[model samples]
Target: MSYSDTNDPAFESMGNAAHYTNIASTLFFAYAVVSFVKDDANDPLFDKSWKQDGFCVTHKEIPFWNSHDACLYFDMMAALLLGALYWKQRNALGMERVNEIFGPSILGILAHGIGHGAVAHRMREMGLPTLAEEDDLDKTTIDENINERIMEINMMDDILGVGEVSERGRNVFVMVCFWVGLMKAALPNLRMAPFAAMVLAAMAGQQFVDRQFAFTYVQTILLVAFSVNQLARKKEEKDFVYATHPMVVGVPVTFIGWIESTQCSAFVKDSFYGHLIYDGFIPVAMLVWYVVCYLQIKESRDNSFESIAKTADRKGKVKVS
Candidate 1:
């Protein structure tokens, strides 16, 4: 059947998801760049001393425009946008389309929320204030001395610091990316959903896993498995795009991500450049591939029309004869 004649709602959903995802990816990428840039003073991203008042708007206690919280906020916003887009178009797109687009997303969002909540709980358990509950210290008159409150605020960074929260957000972002990609590829299954979640959990569960690069190794093994599975299911069909086409690319792309994450990749050793190349390369490449695929399909369709016209002309001449 022709592409336009395709009644497959799932295919249409994939198209919509890809359209929005490309935009989301680009926006996130721009933020990622700004987030990774080191200041002239050589302080790490989000590493600033708390104000003497102890709870200013820019304080780390709340989610500021810093690298860590920015990532979390951006991912949450994008995911909500994706869901809203699908929901608003649901009547036209149908149930299969809606489920395909929203299934992994809802799950991924819950996972991220839970991850953040767990960290917050840990912080409170350690006697660290979860967030700045009060307004600016100037607004609220407290009996406690200024120095005591400042000391407490300093401990906030010490106990409930940037590392775990940012790491968790990063893992959630990666998980969401994979989830959306799998949905777009029309490869979402019962197994794949949990597998993606498992990878996310494992990557974030660094405190549990003492071994270095364990997450990378796990991701590498998963990609290989997915590639092999897709290849094994290969079939001969002109109209059908092989799911394995993108699946195979994922194997090498994932390996590149792994390499870039480690110091072993010296040419771009885990710097801002490496992060950009690692995160940005595959999406851009896939986008170019999509455009080429569209052109090829258009050419094939035009050729098909020409062949039909020629056959009809020949038949008409025979009727005249």
Candidate 2:
């Protein structure tokens, strides 16, 4: 069907979601760059106190930016935004679309596990300190932090009916990545190398498919979800503010993921790059997706109001006659 003539409300909703999500993604990207620039201004390397530290802590110890904290915040924001969008546009998009989009989207995020594990393996093989080690922090602490953040971020995924699948898939994907790392470490020339490479390729393809589907799904879901919520609640301002989180978090992450996947595949062999892709990009894309959806929905809403006004004017004239 032609764009305007397309009868499927879900498709229309998807387009709307994409519009809002794009705007949100742009804003978040700008904010992230600004945050990084502000933090980098301290010049930690020149500081004597920084020199006294055992490990090179310039990047980690920057006073203005805590990478881990920023990542957590971004993920949480993305989750909330996803929830808000789904809550508002569930009907127009339909439950099925919601499930399909969310299922693959979550999987796409999980795919980063392979890249993460691969990078860590490469670093260890080359005798470089792994990121977790370089930070002078225990593995347990990082794991705990990740767990907590996962729960927080996955809360919205659960609400939208794809959280469980995605979470399980992520766990599996991570384990696979770990195994790949171990293989790279223990037996770099094993006969299974070709098979392993094939598996990784398949996983990457799956992730891409999931991500693209999820983006479309979220777009469809957000339009109907928000409109329905607004109708029920009658509190537009409060809901709109609440809805902002999805746009802010989802769009940027999605776009970031696309960029990282395309631009940094070479680096994905390193764990740090993997983490950056998984932790950084996914949340950003989701935020972008939400912003795109929001704009379309808003325009649709405006047109609706105008139509209502015109209809009222016509009826008034008829009644007077």
Candidate 3:
């Protein structure tokens, strides 16, 4: 039996409009980050910022006013908006479709975390004080000017750090919802809620405690489980299979990033090639993944709900006849 076209027109129109809008938004977000990497044209914007003496984006003079800091702020908001947009369309979309929009955004968030960690280390190497050190200042002995400067740096660092962590926490929530939505869209009968909740809790705990290794471990386990779950199905589950790609690819990159952070990997840490690979190349790989996922989703949309309804109707008619 041919699939009914009664609602296909409406659904197709909505999907196509949203699909283009999402692609445009994602490209704009990527361009923003690339533009920042290309030039620090906006550095002049924060010359009068109160905390200009600090070495890191979080500690830079002028709260919320530095070029690098501003990029982070913009990236965070862009990603948050994308995630929220996907959430709003959850019922109308499929698992793979949601991942097509979200997978890259979440990976970018992880990259943002790595970016901050890199900045934190560089600041430490430059002998910059952390927010923790500002408390050691005695209110009475220091000159008013010096005390005020110290307070400013400390406060700015605290605010930026909290913002970073909070952003990651929100990403965790969005990821959990994405997984749940994926399950509902693909494997509707499976009991995946508990597993999804557990995954979220694990990620949130790791984020709160600032445990990157632990978080990575949890992510790895979940990915493997996801892969296994899909393989177990007698019927092929292509979407679930697609879900494993990021997980499998991310583990090695993440481990390398971690290793590069340590003294043991100083050869890679010091070399230009090392910097290129760790800082420049790896993140670009993430951008590539997002672009690929977007294209796949776009190609798959035409055959989605319409195909499902038609297939179901064909079987129903066959049985009746």
TM-scores for all candidates: the values are 0.41, 0.32, 0.34
Q: After best superposition, candidate 1 residue 14: deviation in angstroms? A: 24
| lDDT by candidate, in order shown | 0.38, 0.39, 0.39
Q: After superposition, how far is residue 44 of candidate 2 from its true place, in Å?
A: 32
Model 1 lDDT per residue over 96-118, tens place: 42244244544444344333333
Q: What's the best-to-worst order under TM-score?
A: 1, 3, 2
Model 3 residue pairs with clashes: 49-62, 50-62, 51-61, 51-62, 52-61
Worst 10 residues of 2 by lDDT: 49-58
Worst 10 residues of 3 by lDDT: 46-55
